[model samples]
Target: MTSEEFGAAPTRGRRLRTVVVFHLADVTGPAKSLRPRLEAIARRGGGLDVLAPAEGSLAGAYGDLGTVCALPYASLTVPRTPREAARAVRSFARDVGLFRRELHRRRPNVVVVVTTALPAALIAARLEHLPTVVYVGETFPSRATDGTVRWLGGRVIARLCEALADRLVCCSETVARQFVRLGSTVTIYPGISRIYAEGDRAGFRARYGLEAASPVIAVVGNLTAGRGQDTAVRALALIRERLPGAQLVIAGLPHPRPIDEAFAASVHDLASELGVERSVVFTGFVERVADVYAAADVVVNPARFDEPFGRVALEALTAGRPVVASAVGAIPEVLRDGRDVLLVPRDDPVALAEAVSRLVEDPALRDRLVAEGSRRVESEFGEEAGIEAFEGVIADVLEQRSNGPRSRSSSPG
Candidate 1:
């Protein structure tokens, strides 16, 4: 069989049956964004089944998709001893079995795996003769902390999976390069989702008891160290000196680790010390993120490190709000500094404050950004764009499979 002969079948308009595996127990940004796209795909007459870690948020989120399969998957945290490693290994084995069972039943055309548990999915896809589509939502290995032994083992496994994958979908260009650097074929698919736009301005302001006319600066995401909430708090101190009536509205859950505890405490203490504590409000983890975005005048995503991409920036754009984000990663790709978003250096409270000031003082610039960014997001980075990108990858993979004798990679084969 030759490539040309295999691709002769018209797949340009064909809908494929897909089973997406997300064996992560927690609800991270990536999972939240991917869910709507899968839902949309399922609605379009594509068979969709989700297999997740057999507990917590994953189980609940799975209900939104097709049939849900839950299995054991341990986190890097919790029980760092040798016993924990044994538990993780056991969990991986169980997930492999679950994958096999699902593959047997559905016999899907493609299996979309979304996590680093690639060994099991790759094997199952091979055994079932199913093309595998792997979505790399973030940097592999670096995002989490594991021992040197485990990290090295994971890297080897990831490289093997890369070669075996029929198509790779990454959340950002930075993440896609990690695979591409190793000469693995991949495509850049931005992490995107539709914002929950419901609450009116009055309703949102009342929900948080915020003033109608006060300059409201909103921060959304896990209140982790690298997320740069502390930078926002410090910036608030600077904003107070100029605008005195400025308020900071924080809507996010705290990190699981106590590392953020000290930082959270300091944010409050600094607010009090600067006599601006009354201006600082913390609404810990609101279900409707759009409500917060709607209520705020401006949104800030001042992550200290290079974020793969800032979902909040898109959400703010969706909500018709101006954003001040760090000039890092794929964020710069989405934003045009001073036009769509005000780009600032990461972790610099002074710079964050300056950008915030420009937006607050200049109403024309803020409104211009809000209008332009909203259009950009709706057209380029919303659920619509995400689904199209996903569908494109599926088409390419199936076309490749149909047109030729399969090339096997010994790495994962």
Candidate 2:
């Protein structure tokens, strides 16, 4: 069929087969964030194939999610020095071969990629004339804990990805702003999948042996620096004094850097010193996150630096938990202060502690915040909204390709 013939808007029931590629191995927020939507798409009997850099459990986790198929390539770790660029290229070549094989088999209508590991997929999409969407999370090195050299490398790679991607799908407007800064066409606010249910809470809590009445707080995402897990740990210590029985859940992957081992040890020591170590549970990377949300009276995302977009904040809201996130990056866009969530300044452990304490002490305030947070997630970022946003970008990209190139105009994003 001609591109114009397919230009008619897709109806709600239409099945759209798509291929999503992101070379994330092991457990991390972006992988967790993308899985649900891919599962949903798969359940609709549409083709869904994921290309990732993971083996074992990560591969197995995606396998069980839905009809979507998972291909686990040996993950490419960030290179240390400019001299390692050749090694990085070789790694990318290997991943591209895997992706090409998968694409040849699936022949999906659209291509979606989260990270910069899939320039070949972008090229393939261009060659095949298939619509392509690139979901840019916090770019490497920028999001990495490394300093100047890695940052420079990250910028170079990011520039390459920007040049290749047909359309950029940013996790938040803040991330999209970066692409817009580079004169690229982009969409803001990525989608969230609703895998966990409200009814699953009791079972999940029971499994963890959490007390029925203990005030619970959860921190979801990878255990990395700048993510502010330590801030949450300290906040938990301070919270114990106000709400003596408060329990904190630190979930998701452990810290990515070995240097952070001392920091992790310090957090453990701090917890023990506060005498609330027993109350603080570090449940490393739970498969079913809905339960974590269920067992919590409040959710905290205290990322100490700019996160292109904080996915966990939306996840917490989707799970109907009151979120207290740092007022950094795109958080101010996702939540309202004293309404959907309690926003505190970044890097202030005291502020994080006080917010947790306030929420724990006031039940009414907690309830209101949770309700508002849920409403906001449903209204702006729920499954349907996310799907529409994604599909809209695809439609726009396809339309643009069909219309031919025009003078580039600055987009406000």
Error of 2 at 35 (Å): 5.2
Q: Which prediction has the highest TM-score against the true structure?
A: 1
> For residues 1-413, could you state the per-residue lDDT of candidate 2 as single tens digits?
33443344554444667777765556565666566656665676666666654443556767664334446554445577767868777766765666665665566656887776557667555545566777777745553456777677667656766777777767777766655346465645655666544527778678777888888888887666777887887787777777778888887665455856666667678788777788878887687788888778788999876877777877877777778899987888777898888999987878988988888778899889888877777777766666666656766665665555322222212
* lDDT agreement of model 2 with the native: 0.70
Query: Model 1: which residue pairs collide?
Result: 6-402, 6-403, 7-403
Candidate 1's displacement at residue 168, Å, is: 0.8
For model 1, state the Cα shift of residue 134 in Å.
1.1
Error (Å) of candidate 2 at residue 53 is: 1.9
